[model samples]
Target: MLLALRALLPFSLALLFGCSSTETDTSTEGAAAGIALTETGAHAVTRSKVPFLWREQAYDASLHDSISIITIDQKLAEELTDAERAALGYVTTFIGSECDWDGKANPEFSNLKCKTLSALKLGYQCSIEHLGFLQHWFRNDQEVLIQLASCPRIPFTASSQQTFDEIYLTTQGDTINVWFSASGVNLPMNATWEWTEENIFLAQDDAISLVRTNKSEVIRSELKFDEGL
Candidate 1:
């Protein structure tokens, strides 16, 4: 059964990070506020009339050395297509948005903290599950951080609110794969990255892919109902 299940879940996934617009002007005023975002957050951005009621995702990060996987069952694409769909749901409704969840700059995120983790880890941590699959990261999505912030600590279950077992991040040019272990599990992915400049948020395009392999009988799936963020 374990082997059979593993065979069924054989997968490869990628995320192209970057947001185009914003939905809110957090420029209201705050001590942390550095500059009003050129882009609005998701709240201010208008979406299609539909919300995606179903979706699934798979992810592999070389830096984190983890492969996060998920599958969504019983989706209501038509109904989900309605207004105010979740970002992941919106992406499912339109795959074109796979690269970004929120717009590049939101006024609320003007003075974000310094990125502690290296670009590799930042990128890996940024890699997030969408529609149960991971096509992007949750680096700056306040709504996501608030709702699913607990996921990282939960046991690495594919079910609701579970943590990822192993996370991986591969250096640029397919030269190295950095591994970060959690709960004794191996990292879930081998990734490729390219660094054009030293900046963290450099405006460039690169494909992030990750995968995981295990000996136990674990289930990977995407559920239609949201567990939040």
Candidate 2:
């Protein structure tokens, strides 16, 4: 199950957000306002009309490892796309989690300790791991960015195993480009699935186009955003 989901990741990431756009001179003002709120110890409210209803797929591959042609699950895509469409706003917040490590701790692999165990355990170390979340605010027509954010916290879940972080969005004329970068440790049976360093760009227009690269391989896919269930 984990392996299959990881296999679907590249395609899943591409299809996740490929719908709609916005235009306004106030866009910069809106972006700055959101940033200010974050700086002032508050979360920014995101508003847009691009119903999160985005569903599409592209070929998944890897240049650093073996490659295969895979498409994301259609039913799963429709469900998620519809859910996103219903969601109208997003904000950012941080919560705590648990992460444990032995020897020299790798910040990326483990940093939060959700258990009662002390960080100075006999042969291990632990700490309160803070994770980020997106809060839904009000709705409007200003552009905002959504990144992969965090890596998988639970090994058993499909989301944790195959996801992106730091998704950034920008616009050029009539095109909205979504870019995201991520890094993670390798998992069993998930060689090409684990990315040492990867970046992806989703170019949106009448149709959706993608360009993704990591370590050595590059993937490209063409898709269309479906607004209906």
Best by lDDT: 2
**lDDT: worst 10-residue window of model 2:** 88-97
User: Which parts of model 1 are misplaced by more than 4 Å?
Assistant: 8-45, 51-148, 153-229
Candidate 2: tens digits of C-alpha lDDT, residues 1-229: 7456554443333343222132222233444333211122111222231121122233334423332222222222232221121121121111111222333336564633322112112111111222111112111212221321332233212343333323333332223333333323223333323222322322222222224434533232333333641
> What C-alpha lDDT values do all the predictions have?
0.23, 0.27
Model 2 score (lDDT): 0.27
- Candidate 1 accuracy as lDDT: 0.23
Worst 10 residues of 1 by lDDT: 195-204
Give a tens-digit lDDT track for model 1, residues 41-91: 322222211111112233434333333332111122222211112222211
- The TM-score leader among the candidates is 2
The TM-score that candidate 2 achieves is: 0.23
What's each prediction's TM-score? 0.18, 0.23
